[model samples]
Target: MPQLQEPKLIAGNANMPLANAIARRMSMHRGKQVGLVDARVERFNDGEIFVEVFENVRGEDMFILQSTSNPANDNLMELLIMADALRRSSAARVTAVLPYFGYARQDRRTKARTPITAKLVANMLVGTGIERVLTMDLHAAQIQGFFDIPVDNLYASPIFALDIQTTFKKRMDELAIVSPDVGGVARARELAKRINSPLAIVDKRREKPGEIAEMTVIGNVKDKTCLIVDDICDTAGTLCKAAEVLIENGAKEVHSYITHGVLSGPAVERVTNSVMKSLVVTDSIAPTDAVKKAKNIRIVPTAPVFAQAILNIWSGTSVSSLFEADTLSPIYDGTYAAE
Candidate 1:
């Protein structure tokens, strides 16, 4: 069998820390010689994006790591320009690595005459000559269908399950996994099953964007520690409300494990005053200064998972296998309950 060529990991300005971390992991996995591709991605005075790859990526696979987070448009445009640059430079394949795929919530039109921006974003990428896409915890699974190229949606559930097991080890039996909304029950149930805990749902009605009309806990949480799970926490209104409802229903403590901390607007303040004890989010999107200053917020690095997924894809291995709790446990395994 021919040896697989090492992919050149490229970083965009969106999330430098995460990009560097993933590059390091890739190097470790492929031996010392493999490293990140030296590149330049910046903007002109008029805010025009410019990209240049210093090293030859000709006929080599290139993975561009970027998160369309805050200043979403600029970051997203930067990714498109970078991919175009690589494609024009003759790179064999360009896989976009979006940890927090922004505009994902706008996958569908909730109102009449509204455009499906998610499909537009997918179209933009395909138009840029990109070959594949790798992302984590997409807001809607159907968004993958929007792309003509192959798309791999990674999950943070395994990581969250491991953390939950370690944090609530002795109290596993009294722990409940919660979905802040009906749509997220599957994600919550998967995590709950992994730790052998019961599942709960937060039934909420939204009167308008960013406001919750009514909130209710659908399962018994009295005397139990609840872990609210979701993909995104933009504005954090739903999260805070769910935590409050859980507390009011007698949950001993409430915590959250969200994939993307799009903690925009008054999210920090809301979380600070809420009944939730802590908010754990993956480093899919770089946290804002406010998010960094929040006492209750904790960040879990996601580079390791992305690094492994990149390697697996390049090696023709199953990316879904990474979600099997037992398979990825060696990285951060801990006994969460007495067997």
Candidate 2:
């Protein structure tokens, strides 16, 4: 571990539950160590965001736990201000640990003259004097390259993979990992390999944003249980539509595994009414009430994973192994009870 004289932990206004979880895992003296500022955001008559960090963080290694969840802009501005405050306060280092990096989808210019919003966000973080980044399952991996400072893109796959093994024990081999779109083929394939299963792909043409995607599944999903894997589940049109296509193609069962559950608009209703059996999401960003109460939804806790990463980072240990999801011990792996 890099022996710093005094290490500080700063919790941003976003995802306080998760931040507290990480703090508890660290065994830090709760409110005494990791402090929160009022950060009472207000919109002026003209609609603007203002923030203030009330805590003093001189010569401290500060880590700000925030997620760019809903109201992404507001939460993002809060994080930026927190980092700038820590930097200007004479803190030794500042690392922005975002469990969910919002606006990650706009990582590239799909069309001519389009802005790469993901890159823009990266610039904002680096410009604000963030020393490093520790985030999970960003919409695109290339978002890491956009940052001049080091960006550790963490993975939730190990937690999900282990959950899958226990959730469907004997039937895992009969599974065909399906990607909702060709872009997610790599993620689906990675999960499939962890469980030693085959992979399938769903090819689709986007009709419009927020509309059901008309997809033609590319692989043989007939007579096999299908799991559609992706990084994020927003609106969930693609997942629901993909499930329909797979079922129409003779899939025995359909499920969706997504890392971040940005279930905005009609996502919950769509998934509830779709042919999908269940939607699995991680507790990276806190779930909305609809998702929390949905019978067809299951959440895998990422608190332990985030906590472990924080400890490792603080101790100056390598964190690359944490990104490999399949190696983690499952909650139902016949051991939690013993503890």
| Candidate topping lDDT | 1
Which candidate leads in TM-score?
Answer: 1
Candidate 2 structure, TM-score to reference: 0.90
Error of 1 at 78 (Å): 0.6
lDDT of each residue in 62-174, candidate 2, tens digit only: 78888999979888998888788778888888889999999898988888999999989999999999989999987878889999998888877677677777787768778
- Model 2's number of clashes is 1
Worst 10 residues of 1 by lDDT: 330-339
47-113: candidate 1 lDDT, tens digit per residue? 9999988999889888999999989999999999999999999989999999999999898888899
